[model samples]
Target: MSGKGALSGTEVATHNSRASCWIIVHGKVYDVTDFLDEHPGGSKIILKYAGKDATCEYEPIHPPNAISDNLPPEKCLGPVDMGTVKRVEIKITDQEKARLGRLQLRPPLDEILNLHDFEAIAKLVMPEKAWAYYSSAADDEITHRENHAAYHRIWFRPRILRDMTHVDWSTRILGHRSSMPVYITATALGKLGHPDGELNLTRAAAKHGVIQMIPTLASCSLDDLMDAAQPGQVQFLQLYVNKDRQVTRRIVQHAEKRGIKALFITVDAPQLGRREKDMRMKFDAEDPDEVTKSGGEVDRSQGAAKAITGFIDPGLSWKDIPWFKSITKMPLILKGVQCWEDALEAYDQNLAGVVLSNHGGRQLDFARSGIEVLVEVVEKFKEKRGITFPNPRFQLFVDGGVRRATDVLKAVALGATSVGIGRPFLYAFSAYGTEGVDKALQILHDEFEMNLRLIGAQTIADVVPSMVDATNIHSHVVAVPGDRLYDSNYESMQHARLRETTRAKM
Candidate 1:
């Protein structure tokens, strides 16, 4: 089994051996055993490259700085043969590593573990315009900053030394179980971050035992996203409401046929918001063709602009929501609802769920942060509207500015049944591609697990409002009265018309 005569036999024998061994690549060694369960691309790829020279192949599969000397030596699992493996590594510089470390890495975690960390890194990794496109709010980005900043405003009363050891982060969303309470939000143009795009993201999400919301404007096709996402892995579709009704119908039908359990129809963007970053960059939202033509060569910074140009479809409305609902029995979740009024409306319309969000502050600049509205929305439904569903009941998911396990716990305590993560996953995608995304998610899961134990909560259900001080949570005042803030524009116009009509009657 040791010589050239037995080379093939030795290789065959090693594959079955229970013994684990280390492999060296680029002057670094990695312990492959522990990573078997954690491989983002799948264990088969890691297994195939086991005990072999995998440097060239693995090198191309990850961002350059992702496997640097600064990373734990244990995380390096040797090199593998490229001929039989799928290699997908986007170019990442050593400088980028230092930058990501300095900007994105929160002490003890070099990768994005939470939402804020991702937002910070995204600003660094992308051009000012692209970053603003993802991170900016409608007018002033007030909600964007507040979404994360508000998390600190809520103080957690942690109870120490309550449990002996056992803890679990696993939970279920819309009948699908996940390893943690958080899931990846559907963000368009993933190819901007890496070539594998949504395909890689869906695969990574499934591998991690969490849910992934596939966006309507995904770089990959719906069929491909569904195929990559394994069965029972909690894959949901995010609809951007394209102008063509037939296109929107096609997307909804595709999700239904593919077993997607939820339809996350984004409701905030009746028209694209005024993003100053994109505005400053002279980004033409109406003409994606011009932007793509102007953006030369897809690099880390400018890729998103080019990618976004391909996916953003402007026309969609509330009418389309019921149309989608009528077509599919799968649960419908309306994303980007920023106020109690819309949440109440969603409940009144009998939708399965509502995601309190500000589009990661990417859509509206001056909108209220999603976390700022979480408690109010939840209270409106649970108490005011008397809205309740069967068994697990109706859920409220929140996103935009969620960056820490505490942030997630805070949102949950405030009435969010679960939370969605956006920019952070994109940063992970940019920084380390799929592996980076997986590492980022794992860190968040770990943080949630540890925090749940520290707080003496055994399960996600145990994370209740009692853990949060409701009085301290931030609140905002809407100028318009009643629970119908969406009609603000219409109300103003109606008032003017009524005054004219009254004068005529007089």
Candidate 2:
């Protein structure tokens, strides 16, 4: 299997039908005929690349181990001879060529002053498929926009005449030290943006003393990331529970064994949303007939999320809470708790914490922002628990649209343990690799120093509720000035234009 037993492109191209499908992915030949019927994205898509190198289509959305993990060992048809393998000549359009050109022309890392700058440059430089997948939110994208908009409603009640001396943003997340009051939150399929993917995050987190939440569907395999971690660097695992309990059990136990500091059970996304932009760039559009043939109610239109996340167990409920506890000693934190009732229940359940997030508005459209949810959680805590956060027994955290240090400060003041920023770090590495992340951290450090003094605080602990007035945080109808930076940088919601019908060749 390891030898030069390479098949020529001519020999591979002969088997081009559904009955005997052959394909090459990353220089490896695989006879996916049997696996076709069982493939989650359906057979037609794989069948579309029958007898061809599918590496271009296969790379972005799927994890590196996806083919190996899902395909039977017998189907892996050994190595492909690259010298004889005919290259798939894709005609590059002018727009695409210009987009690719931006990669070489990106501004220097030092010029990128804030998280938004990374987003701006990444949008300009990233390939269309990658940008579409990374930026797409749920239907209408109301909550997606609101995630950042909610921050504008809260006004800072800055105090003057403070000592104005040395400020410290360093704090602990899940009992581990951090350089700032923020964590690099989980985002799937890192290789879509950069070659190294989440390893970029792992390296950046290690360098700066922040926790990186490993996504279940990361392009890099679990061991790939765990192996890359520096000694004693705290990591967290975000679970998208598999329907097969054994698989879920193995994953949870393995993460615990690997010394993951905490287990973040994703309580949202019972179903991945209709990310239309991703759907528009359909990878599996070639085989719509497979849906009828397979006799499954699969939605081929949901794009990358549907294809990759088909394995997540939608049956996850409160009953499964104790089952998660029965599996590992790692502290449990619900990664997507929405409202006060759920947060209260999490407290009663003896869970370590709750992340007030809506899966970064990728799950449900119009879902309230995490910071807004934090308001209700803090209010409930003050009512019942008689504590306004700093509650070691059950910490509460928030994530989503955290572009500025001021947002973290606001959440901390309103009773959050810390905040999580996902997309910015993703954009950072996408634009300039690991150094982009380091620079983003440095910018935050500068902002934390200035913002803390302005708000009359010397440390994270001093960022109290009085420092930020959130009287309008929950007012969903209130009109706030639009975030021009985010709006200008954001690619607006794309409605899929109908594909042009092919004409008969003369």
Which model scores highest in TM-score? 2
- lDDT over C-alpha atoms for residue 461 of model 1: 72
TM-scores for all candidates: the values are: 0.65, 0.91
Model 2 lDDT on a 0 to 1 scale: 0.86
lDDT of 2 by residue, 388-415 (tens): 6878888999999899999999999998
lDDT (Cα atoms) of all candidates against the true structure: 0.62, 0.86
In candidate 2, residue 211 scores what lDDT?
A: 88
lDDT, residue 322, model 1: 70
Q: Which pairs of residues clash in candidate 2, taking residues 3 or more apart in a chain or in different chains? A: none
Write down the TM-score for model 2: 0.91
Error of 2 at 389 (Å): 0.6
